[model samples]
Target: MNSAIESLTLDVPDTAAAQAFYDEAFGLGDRLRFTTTDAHSAGFRGFTLSIVVAQPANVHAFVDAAVTAGATVIKPVAKSLWGVGSTLQAPDGTIWKVATTAKKDTAPPSRTVEEIILLLGAADVTASKAFYVDRGIPVAKSFGRSYVQFETGPASIGLGLYRHASLAKDAGVAASGSGSHRLVVNGALGTAVDPDGFAWAPAEVRAGA
Candidate 1:
């Protein structure tokens, strides 16, 4: 059996507002879902949802839409040794990163997201990597104790593990946070919480699946 993250359910205080913002910003379609909750969450959620695009133009397009939809700019769009990217916090307090490795635009600017990655900030990357591997997810890439990327197959969203503090630094936020993660990962890994307190529920069969 192949293991993968089927989808992510974000707990927001207002589902309607979240729906509107997501639609206007990235047009994620069914790639992400939201539920209503009055959960007390503060500071960084110990995770980030990254929208990987094809080029800088595509990155700018999504960031502009997100800003127009009321997202707070956490990090201004700029060129880095790795790529061109920007960071923002959603109205509901979820952190997001829009990035791409291609510095130049090959095609016209559009909101074209190549991949959606869920990066979890773990206190111990090696331990967390072992936990996932034991659950049947294979490792796609590993950088010692700093980072780990799992092979979640082509049909599912990408998953990765990074040092907690480093993850927060990359997102341009402080590492201190409390309360619920306000996020639930649905996958074949069964119902369980990882060492970092990320909740995972059984995968649900969606319409297209």
Candidate 2:
């Protein structure tokens, strides 16, 4: 009844071998709660998994106990990083992992968000790159066939091809041509014009030549 879900870990593949390893490494004795299945194999599921070779007689007893506790064993127990795991859905509708833990390694997926790239989708990348270069910005990389990235002091700007139809679809605005983007740099309101005749530069431009 506690709020947190304690991970139910399982051992996989060779139970005796994995148990031996754990016994030596972590000193886990009698912690191996053997669940029986009707088949000659004990499957892993719900936070962990394992592929267990039964004593050939207690399979049905294990399967019945699990089912009575609202555990659904959905497939053949197979070997994995823990031993063998079988897919089982918990009573709460959450797909719980039931795997047999062995000596093999397992790595989860992960990543880091460094920065956000502003996709300034454009029509002409070559000309656009030239425009940014003239404006005191350095080119980082060309986004292959459709866009390019320019270095922004602490951030990065992406230049993408601007298609009128696609842009209209994207913004859900009635777009005949490119729209205006207002920018506030160092306390001044600036405007930039594209294919459309929109007011886009600040009245007072920056102080450097």
Best by lDDT: 1
Per residue, candidate 2 scores C-alpha lDDT tens digits across 147-174 of: 4555554422122333334433333333
For 75-160, candidate 1 gives per-residue lDDT tens digits of 99999999999999999899999999988998989887799999999999999999999988999999999999999987788999
Point out where model 2 deviates above 4 Å. Answer: 1-114, 143-145, 155-209
Candidate 1, residue 124: CA error in Å? 0.8
Q: Which 10 successive residues of model 2 have the least lDDT summed?
A: 1-10
User: How far off is residue 64 in model 2, in Å?
Assistant: 41
Local distance difference test values of all predictions, in order: 0.92, 0.34
